[model samples]
Target: MGTCKCHLKLRKPEDAAAACSKVLELDGENMEALKNRAEAHILAERFEQAKQDAHKAHEKDQNDRSVMEMLQRIDRLIKMASRKDYYKVLGVDKLTATARDIKKAYKKLAVQWHPDKNQDNLEEADKMFKEIAEAHDVLGDEEKRGKYDRGEDLNEQPQGHPDPHTMFFQNGGFPGGGGQRFFFRQG
Candidate 1:
């Protein structure tokens, strides 16, 4: 656990994951190990793996706040990835869209995809609503829209924030040997 924490503190999520995995091998039901590994996977942008670990940890302790928070975060990331093309979600042309145009598109889609209006497919509609809202949130704001137009990540990390996905890929940390296929394809 200490080794895992050290690796995480150093922003070496792959190492933390490995250390946590070792602990899990010794005790599959170790809540601490599961929680640590879930966080490590999340830092690595391995949302599915994180979700799995979080689910296990939640099962072990339903009252665990950290576990529940990790699950929620993983779910949000998964939803975001499922509908990554913000322009597509809003049904707007990125190059030609004005703020007004984007707003109109968002409103149209929001009403159609709103979960309350889609009782039979509440889950799907909820996901779509979240995606539409996320798209609009970015495109509606002038500064964020400008950043997006410039090919910058509108959700750019704050200063000194490390991107674990880049680090994981750069260090050849893909789960399987070949590394030919990514576990999670963003967008």
Candidate 2:
């Protein structure tokens, strides 16, 4: 006899793998055991092995929804792992992030994206810099800054910043007339 799937659900990957192996020994074609083990591997982020196990489960039961779901999940995880976050790129955390820290992170990131430093790549650096700038801007404002620290939604537009098109227009730009005026041409 081997452990049921539920018994191994919350266990560590290694433990789940052991239980799954036992289940497989009892019945080599146990799709449930294979799927559970694949899930465990996903939690552990052993993606390649997880992909293999998920593929095997799909093979065993071609029409199984669980297998298809697991494969889609694995694809998403693999993609997420490939794209790094700005915090990781800067090597800092929100708790300790001061203006100085922001400057330092920017400098380091600039170096990484610098045309001289990365002769073969340029676009990635710009995208990284934009993210860094946005993070700094939100964290720097006092009300927005405090909200961010409290894990509130800082992305919400600030209260006083007027809608540009509705409130003001000058030379088709903004903030000044700049020798041009904008008004509805009403007859």
Candidate 3:
């Protein structure tokens, strides 16, 4: 038995990782700590460490989905790391595509590989969708697209962002500074 440290519940990856590491310092074979730390390692992009930690946790508990997902993400990220160029991800040539052209290309590819349209190959479709989403997301935003063009880090937000309010407020501004004042009728 080791010294019991502070018992704190972590809701985020960094905190979880710290707690897990502290626990592991006390007990190396702690499965829960290993899994939590592995997840944090993945979030932190420490793929090799994540893979090792996930493997250890998985060996202890084979039914852990978090461990399995982390392993799969690490494998995919390793593959993607080989093809870091955004143009390659979108299957497009450099300087030949405008933003609209990229959108059209993404739409075409998305429709072709949409999971609903390809029921027999959902996994493949999902992978294609993710690629398309990533490509479109980068190429659609000016800042991200420019970074991507320069081969800089462009893992930013994506495209087709819809308004959450559904155009409730027009360009001319709202009725009474924001909303309308309604008088309730006495029953």
Candidate 4:
């Protein structure tokens, strides 16, 4: 246990996990070992393993603040993973994408999915358009892209951040600022 703590304090999470694993082998119900292992997994970007250790720690000590925090972090990681991937939505390859690549992909997808162009499948097109717009809005901005890359929560729009829908209109997605009220069927 002390060895685990020492490794964690030295910022060696893999070593800490190994130490915690050793302790768990001797005492499987050790709360400290579970909590430490969970945190180490989190730092290692193994969210699934972190989730398991966090749940086990929570089960052993429901009132532990560290355990609760681990659970919360695990939840955030899970939610972030499940959210729409902006790169996939924009059709840009994340590994070799430049800003120009992102913009070109967004333009192509937006035109392809525009509601006016897909009148036969208006609802689906509108949904696709919105997704494309949001993907562009995030991936286009460096600050937002950095945060997104770090896997931070971006559910709330910060003050002054442009709305993806309005941004599409401002970029002349619709001729003469027309289509928002008529083209998309509000459900």
Which one wins on TM-score? Answer: 4
Q: What would the TM-score be for candidate 2 when compared with the true structure?
A: 0.50
Encode model 4's per-residue lDDT on 95-128: one tens digit a residue.
Answer: 8999999999999999899999999999999999
TM-score of each: 0.48, 0.50, 0.40, 0.54
All models: lDDT? 0.86, 0.71, 0.71, 0.88
Clashing pairs in 2: none
lDDT of 3 by residue, 12-120 (tens): 5566677778889988988877876776776667778878988998898899787788788778766555665656666777678777778778888889989999999
| Between candidates 1 and 2, the TM-score winner | 2
| lDDT of each residue in 1-187, candidate 2, tens digit only | 2454554555567777778878888888988888888877887889888899899999988999979988987987886566544455566786677768866877777666665665567677667666766655665466766765544445556588766675566335655646565789778
**Candidate 2 residue spans exceeding 4 A from truth:** 1-8, 90-187
What's the lDDT for residue 19 in model 2?
Answer: 81
lDDT tens digits, residue span 10-32, model 1: 98999999999999999999999
lDDT of 1 at 172: 79
